[model samples]
Target: MGKNRDGGGKDDEIIRASDDLLTSLSKDPSIMQSIYALLPNQEKLQGARDRHRSLFHQVVDGAHDKEAELEAARNDLIAQMSLVNGMANLTGKHDPTIPQKLGLVHQTAGKRPSAAGLSVPENFRMAYDGRSIIVRGSAVKGARSYEIWVCESDPLTEASWRHHATSGKINRIEITGLTPGRLYYFRIRAVGASDTGPWSNFISMMAI
Candidate 1:
């Protein structure tokens, strides 16, 4: 037996001492073959673990991309719906009169007892010449007369509306004494003996 440099037994000495009791079994080559066979299985297990880790990361990344795409699609759908609703509201059955033109009146016989239907032409125009507004629109059917209301603020709000002009069975009316560079709202309504109709839709004009 040889002594180790570190004052321990050498490798060969240690092996030989352990083999003395099993000298016959130590010579069996089948035992050494069994130990070597387990190494390939260990390598396979390590490869499987690495592949599983890579697949997990791929799934996480895919989920994040899908979430982002869904969010973008939802926003696009909302914008499209809003545009459709706005167009529908503009072309609906409601009247399109300016605020300054609104008044109380009746149109039809039976309907005259109720509310008078209000209307305003699509091509109606308003122009301000220094001090007065020239409002032009076609006459509404069954309207005996029209009343025009003008106000600096919204006419629907109380204390903001003021009478600007009134017309007798005519389609055109000119409003005077209005300030230049100011915004004006107008509407028109029809009148009957018993009651006055609902005010027409409001239209706005910016005085030049």
Candidate 2:
């Protein structure tokens, strides 16, 4: 149980624990399907976990320009933790033993992390270069990382948006692999240690 001095828990230890849990869940899809009814889909949860693991190793290697990668990894891990915690809470209400069986602790009701002090990002701007969209925003206080979401659907509603990327850099975050000449709506939010801030006003642009 390696933990940091601040008690935030060690990234390596977390990755190890998460890997074990993911393996167990993956080995038995029936149990996972039942447990995930009130939680995020298994694929999304595992994808986030894998992204965190990959980025964690990159940071450990002392690679250059890894700060942003580290932040993104931390953000992804945080989201997964939140989802697991919620799942634990829901499962505990029905059967206390289930959480332990799944390698998760029962989260107390109404004990979600507070987002009170976190502020939404400001001065967000965007431009397109070839097939990439360059986004910039003013960093928020106490922000651990930033998340970018893009909506490609027309008559864009709230549910149409999907997470695009996460980064530590606020000055210039480039999002590539977009369809050329397609219209895209983008927005950003700041992720704090305990919670996330509200998303900024979304802006639209042509990817080309």
Candidate 3:
């Protein structure tokens, strides 16, 4: 009876170990689903996934190539536009189609004469005041004040000499923030209540 009981005890231990392994595998849903699906159609699923992945990559590569071709075409169009603009300027005929910009260097604009006998500002003179140049001139009849213009380089064209400063109804004005010993060109115009006057002769002076 003792020998029979010992053999039965070993058999019970072996059966308990097998039950524990089965319980662990049953707790994992992913492992159970994988095993069930593979048993039915594993080969068909793998082949379909491989074919779809290859098609997806081919579509992505074609899109990238198309984008590169479009970028190259856009660059070519911009270069052609620049060339056309250059040709127009060479023929001394500015394209009216081009929009005007403030920062762009424009062609000289025609000036209409002021009401009769309105000449340039008279007695226009300058004297150094510390780091500034003092421009002084009296206004003639029909004149209100003056507009002053200055540039390091002479802007000979009327459009380039856009008035830099406007003075009060006084004869004297000071230009501050000048570089000492630097030569500056200045021009002035008599301004009436209604309209601007013709520009005066260019006056070149060195800042003291």
Candidate 4:
């Protein structure tokens, strides 16, 4: 009735505009009576808009909740997939034929015979980068992993050495977040399926 303004906008915008229109119509009973007898009254239209507006808001909130649930489910599945693939890779390393049967690419390297006992890593060296140290050592045969140990105090004190990181790579391990000018002692040990080797001779490096 108020200049026949545009309709069919957003739910909240339309609802507010309808409320103002209803208030204007209530003040003028003459205009209300002039409405065709078959047409809905001002009160009925306002009630319908309010009901639908409430339902619209509920549906919007439900959609957001459902989206969050979907994201969490997807992340969980991704983590499980990573775990399964890592297991498959380890299995393939031991048995090269298994990867082909499982439809996974097998990395073919010269297969070294399994050692009776794990051997200690040797030739320990450290390079001083501007912000970090790159530690290297000779690879041990049949080694599955390398454990890096670091000592901030006296290297002679066995209790001072603490486990730093375990690397899948044999050499060129980068250690970061070191305090500048601090002297760090690092050592390495080879880990095999059946045995853990003794620690290598410690190497020292000063953080820049």
Lowest summed lDDT window (length 10), candidate 1: 104-113
Model 2 backbone overlap count = 0
Tens digits of per-residue lDDT for model 3 on 1-208? 1223312224444456668758878888687778565332335535444544554565567755455545544444333333333323223224433322311223222233467545566666676433356788756567777788876532443453545677875456877776874555677777777877777655556565
Residue 176 lDDT (model 1): 72
The lDDT ranking, best first, is 2, 4, 3, 1
lDDT of 2 by residue, 1-208 (tens): 5545533435675577668778988898787678556455678778878887787787788875887977877776655655554445345657877555765432222223235676667777775433356788777878889999987652124676899899987888988878864556677888988788777655556554
| Backbone clash count, each prediction separately | 24, 0, 0, 0
TM-score for each prediction?
Answer: 0.38, 0.44, 0.41, 0.43
Worst 10 residues of 3 by lDDT: 101-110
TM-score of 2: 0.44
Report the candidate with higher lDDT, 1 versus 4.
4
lDDT values, one for every candidate: 0.50, 0.67, 0.55, 0.60
Model 1 residue 39 CA deviation (Å) reads 81
Clashing pairs in 2: none
lDDT of 3 at 108: 26
Off by over 4 Å in 2: 1-114, 129-131, 154-156
